[model samples]
Target chain A: MADLATFDVQSMNRVDLVTVSGRIDSSNAGQFDEILKGIVGKGRNNIVLEMNGVSYMSSAGLRALVSTLRTCKRNRGDLRLAAPSERVVDVLKLAGLNSMFSSYPDSVAAVGSF
Target chain B: MSQVEAVFPARFAEIARICALVQLEAAAAGFDEKEQFRLQLACDEACTNIIEHAYGGENRGNIRVLIRQRDGSFLIQLHDTGRPFDPSNFELESSRQPSADLAELQEGGWGLHFMHSIMDEVRFDFDMDQGNTLTMIKVHP
Candidate 1:
């Protein structure tokens, strides 16, 4: 079975922090989506996605991020990305998503942006 | 130099990892790193769509991927025994529009559009007896 590795979610300074490891593609993209939905469901809008441990991401992963961003905006919240690997950054740039979201060098910076 | 094949789950996560391998190998074959990443994103979108929509969310079938080099180009074929669906039927969204508005963006519906925009050539073959096959090609430019 193709697994999406693991994802850890926490809260800090009123920002919902999500840390994703491993790969995010078709199989596990939905799981990530559900996790984001759950967090948004709790009405926590300020969000930071930390991708330092992520080795790979597909367009499906990008889709999940976009979805989360949309949900945050709908609820008057914001989403930021932090510390993506070079490979992950490359995909974001190719998709032109790098410019669409606020990106910080680390989780602390990202959280502080809130 | 030659051809390679890998089979993985019809799940989204596995497809992403396999596509990453394809990008790495394609980059090593002299393709520009940017183009390589585009190919990886396109492949991931296509394969993930298959696993989700075509496979009926079963998540337990085999997805066969074939990578070959031909005529100074790289060819990838993805084969799955899922429901028959043609990717060519839908009109793809243009990549020219910036994803600026989070309200205008979508999560699931954009996969097909993303795949079509990045690949140089994409085609679909449906075999009632065999399965659905997606063939994509990227020429080194």
Candidate 2:
């Protein structure tokens, strides 16, 4: 799969902030899940996905987030969202998955929440 | 507007192209940015369902997509020569809603839910000649 989405991960003391930018669809959603799972595998379950740069996300992307969230919770950590665009938030709300993940206005607040 | 049709292999790689084409029609039909995103999301989920359920895998079949505009409605029809399936049944069979509870949320059922919620109308039909067809309509407001 091509890099329909790209991300840079910054490991904070209490959280790993991943700034993701691009379209997320069925084509690249598996890769997105793998990347997040890799971070969780490394014992960094507290994650904040900075998503203002994400222009689009489908159910496949949402599935990845759910799976990652479940894993994080099992490890006594969490996956949080930060600064998602209105479009992405609409999709999140449409799928009724918005409440599963906490949203922060900025990465600083997201990291502080952890 | 006249109906526009395109056929592509039932592969995950082709979903983006299929969605981009339909989005062009939706944009030309004067749908707003939010509506365009909704149309795109619905189309993406529909195609994903076809690939995963109807064809059962990628490269197993082809998907025929038809988009048309009439009155204030945008119509999207997806035809696949795979299996006879009903999307509503999938929704009915799944007892899970991801939003209902965080601890028990699962990932497999959101595609059909999004298609129904985002689109004004969603219907499924199966025919001997048509195989399986999923129709979705969005009204421009």
Candidate 3:
């Protein structure tokens, strides 16, 4: 409904780099999903989420991440999580969803993985 | 010692405002950073459900939050009057670890689980005239 989270998507060679900051919750997960759709549309599947700036994420955000992973993998792309803040990491850990995605210590390493 | 309360329109835009108050109350209650985040997430999921399900994302009606610390426990209650849906009657499909199969990855059932998991106790009360009140309790044990 509002700008809960904002992210910049860029193409770095063959990788799609997504730098996201702010909170991701139920209210704006659809808008977040739309942003991801645009990236996948451009044929860059290996997406890296630099989540150091994300202050919080709810189950809705978790769902968005999972579905996005599904979409990317369906297209032979993958979503790599990089440098998730402690809070974000805890949420993922609590949900048991952390291991579902490949996590990197930083964007440099995440982007390098693809 | 004293009660803290806030009421705002049941709008998604007001979530940040509500969450800020939750953070303030949790900190004042002497909750640690992890407990604060758990309280915040529990509150967020509760409020989000009210906005999306109760209000049908229309952003109408009002939601009231009540917070207080009593006997070494933090109590938070969210009240809303959109529709009377009892959480106890609903199944918590995603309460356990999500499935490894990609097709079983879910989205909608997570709010209840988060509320149930992070809080030490969770309960719901509602009536035709009183609306719904979600009570979440976390005791420092």
Q: Which prediction has the highest TM-score against the true structure?
A: 3
Q: Could you arrange the candidates by lDDT from highest to lowest?
A: 2, 3, 1
Query: What are the TM values for chain B, all candidates?
Result: 0.84, 0.92, 0.91
**Whole-model lDDT, candidate 2?**
0.86
iRMS (Å) per candidate: 3.8, 3.2, 3.5
Q: After superposition, how far is residue A20 of candidate 2 from its true place, in Å?
A: 1.1
Off by over 4 Å in 1: A1-4, B6-9, B20-24, B32-37, B59-61, B93-99
> lDDT per residue, candidate 1, B28-53, as tens digits?
77887667767777787777678677
lDDT of 3 at A108: 97
Model 3 Cα shift for residue A18 (angstroms): 0.4
lDDT of 3 by residue, B4-67 (tens): 8989898776777787888888888888888887888999888988888777874678899998
Residue clash pairs of candidate 2 = none
Q: What is the C-alpha RMSD of each candidate to the true structure, in Å?
A: 3.1, 2.2, 2.1
lDDT tens digits by residue: candidate 1, A5-106: 589998876999999887776667779889998999889999999999876677767877888888898888988889987767877776667888888999
DockQ of prediction 1: 0.43
**Which residue pairs collide, candidate 3?**
none
Q: lDDT tens digits, residues B1-141, model 2?
A: 667998999999998888888878998999888888889888999999899999899999999999999998999999999988965686694334555767766677788888877888888889998699888898888
Chain A (alone) TM-scores for all candidate structures: 0.92, 0.93, 0.90
Clashes of each: 5, 0, 0
